[model samples]
Target: MALSPKTKYNIKRILPFGVIWLILGALFLTVEHLALGNQKNALNSAIKLQPDVVLFALTGVTIIGLLVGCIEVLVLRPLFDRKNFATKIISKFFIYFFFFLIVILITYPIAASIEMDISIWDQKVRNRYFDFFLSVTNLSAMIQLGFSLIVSLLYSEISNNVGQNVLLNFFTGKYHKPVVENRIFMFVDMKDSTTIAEQLGTEEYFKFLRSYYGAFSNAIVKNHGEVYQYVGDEIVITWTLKNGLRDNNCIQCFFDMKSDLYKKGHMYLKKFNMQPDFKAALHFGQVTTGEIGVLKKDIFFTGDVLNTTARILGLCSTYKEDILLSKALAHKIMLDNNYSFKALGEHRLKGKAAIVEIVSLLKNP
Candidate 1:
């Protein structure tokens, strides 16, 4: 069975944890070998760093990493997602520290047994395990593991806060210098937002918007779209030209989001005494992307396409359509049988000389 979008996203989020642990495990092994080389032969027998020991350590560390990831995803996230970074780090460290102790207690015996060619239940294995655990080598390894866990937790918190893609780009310097690239933009604006807010009042309207915006996440993730910005009641989603065209993801995202909100319409009515809806416009053009700001850096996209997309979104109410795409962008997309398109004819947009043709798209029943 295919995984849900959220599941896929969670997997992506959890993978880094496993990778981080694997690297740390290898590093620990290398450090152990170097440290053992410096120590007397008498200490080497207490904690053997054999081939089997190496494989077992790496495997155990990876499994522990995945378990830590699951704990964070399933338990820690929902409980402390809204908390401050310090609080999250503190909580995660303590929880993972407990697991770390459990791992050492359990894996040491098995590792020792494998090295000594005896069953873990044997008293010799237990004696060796305790000796190793109390040694300075184990103490050093434990300290390193503790530090690695903290680093991993910090990475997770920052990656989540800045978005995985954005964080990667920052690390890779993909947008440090301005570069122009063809990209697709979708401007989704909440319909009748002003009226809804007035009816729901300020506090309730805020809650309504929260639920409404949250509904877009799954669809956007499934379609490989990145949320560029949220402007009041409107949101800007963007994709690379290739990504937008693949499987007609850009168009499919709109329908999926619409379906999701429709599914949640009853909840909105129950909680806020109203249903919220959105209209979107799609356009594609060249845009310059770059990082800006010294105090707080961020990736920024600047282009006429964004403004044109916004203007096209404004035409949605006039054309009586929920989704409108520029004729240029519509022609580029290899639309599937699931959708039907209607030409909305040429129109002059404000602050532009070009008369651009527009098309309205609908999902066929």
Candidate 2:
């Protein structure tokens, strides 16, 4: 399970507080030993200090530090995880203020109990102890906050980079290691893609492809479809029949893409004078899917199902169709009010042993 950004940020923020607490606790112990001034034998010197007072002071400092550290690590860190920079800065300020206030409240009584008074004690002694306590607490808080911010920034940058790489690999066919199973395969290929590419020149054509891929990929993912590959101006999308062929989600996804493209394609064409359009083929059956090759690995689907889908795509020009689905898909999905499809009857798909039934969706009923 992924941690929420806020939770991760919070953990990073509080880590410094924990380190500071430990250091301050250790400093308190060392200071107590020195104040007693039994350097000939430090242990003996420590023992000479009123045992009860020594124990109380040490115990108080340790307990306070432990409490503060625990709160920071457990409660504070999680709250700031993944927050925006402005929010994070505000959160840090509040956390520091609260921590400082709590520490002062806890320690002031202990100071009073020891009868440590600025007016009564020598200026050096009073100033030294007061300054030491305040400095240690404040320094610890500041260090922890600074460390947390740096860590959070680094973490965010790293995560963003990783996510970008994953998305890139996904589209580029580098990270596609297909899990073998029976599935419905759909391929959408832009019509006149070569002419569009030729007309636009290389850079603008590549930009158009990226934008087209983005829109199509969004639709596929939204419909729980896995986009397997992009071959030139074509995209291959796959989904399990058990889940994907019901309620016409796959068809709906195409319509959504059409609507999106119709709205955006014109703007692209205005610059390039090349309208974007596509033809799609959907087929269902058993197929083996996996990564192929050793050096240049790629996800591949094997068996007659792939060949037949390709043939159906070839018939798009003959039938004057924009989208084609096999009878198997249309039969399973077109029963409900949400879908309607027109049967084109059985036709001999090239290089196929049997004639395949094809259909085109009319509209969402």
Candidate 3:
């Protein structure tokens, strides 16, 4: 069977470790070559007399890199992410044990193929091979791999701390000043958060929130939404108009978040005695977006659209609805018999003079 796209991508990611292995392997071989210049051993003396030291370093580390790369892509990643605790521990133990043995066996073959040494089976030659394998080459590769691993971890941490797209936008200066852009906004708040916190207590409530938000993360990403802010028990998600309407991503995002939390209901009940339920209000309009703050800068959004969005969210509890949106957003979407929405009539919301036509969205039964 062909490898999956995810596996192919992972293999490409790991292949660059080969360069680190090659550099370390070259340094280790050069040191050994220099040290052997004074060795009394006949085999070491003869091998040091040869001009193939650089050749050996390049070939041997290439093999080590290839093996290590395969081990990471095919074995370690799957083992590390195993959902079952016992299986993860047991599989990792055997995988590492087998990994070291395979790398060692491949080392000498790579050397012989590149150097074309015919006396490779002789006692002196075999001893030298065993000594080199046990002493420097593979050991050097392993040590250099630790450095590569650290770099990879640091890079991932930085990317996560500042979102990948946000970092790119900063460098590109996409929002240097307040610029008007059409955006779709969703203000999602946990239902009865104050009551839930009172029932669960502070510590447990925090844990509950952790699980609750974590569950919705995948849905938001899959639906092309950027989490604009996370306040107390609410998450504000936004998207460009083009992305929001594509495949009905904005609408699908709500259903996906609802389904994600619904699926985790039993787990939440078992641990925390309650699962989080939320209400959301979505609207689409022009908003001014800019980089704001001097102490710790953030890309900020302003204008009446946000206030209108918050007020729409306020109507949820009063109207006893799970999802609500202004007609502004509804009018732009391609409904096409895919969803059901009911007109709630035009009303002047609490903080605004102008009336907004709102609607309640229902899952098509």
TM-score of each: 0.89, 0.54, 0.66
TM-score of 1: 0.89
**Whole-model Cα lDDT of every candidate shown, in order:** 0.87, 0.65, 0.74
* lDDT score at residue 340, model 2, on the 0-100 scale: 74
Model 2 lDDT, residue 216, Cα: 71
For candidate 1, the 10 contiguous residues with the lowest summed lDDT are 38-47
lDDT of 1 by residue, 1-365 (tens): 98976788788888878888999889877876886784465374356677888898899888888888888777887789778888888888888888888888898888888888988899998777777777976777689889778878888788877888888799889998998999999999999999998888999888888899989888999998998988899999999999999989899999999999999999998888888889999999999999999899989999999989989999999988999999999999887788888998999999988899999997878
Which candidate would rank higher by lDDT, 2 or 3? 3
List candidate 3 stretches off by more than 4 Å: 1-143, 167-180, 288-297, 350-354
Give a tens-digit lDDT track for model 2, residues 267-338.
877766766888899888888766577885455678788888889998888899999999987777745675
lDDT of 2: 0.65
Candidate 3 lDDT tens digits, 193-308:
99999999999898888889889977887787888888999999999999999988999999999999999999998998877899999998889998888898788889888999
Off by over 4 Å in 2: 1-180
Cα displacement (angstroms), candidate 1, residue 5, comes to 5.4
Positional deviation of residue 95's Cα in model 2 after best superposition, in angstroms? 22
The per-residue C-alpha lDDT of model 3 at residue 154 equals: 38
Model 3: what TM-score? 0.66
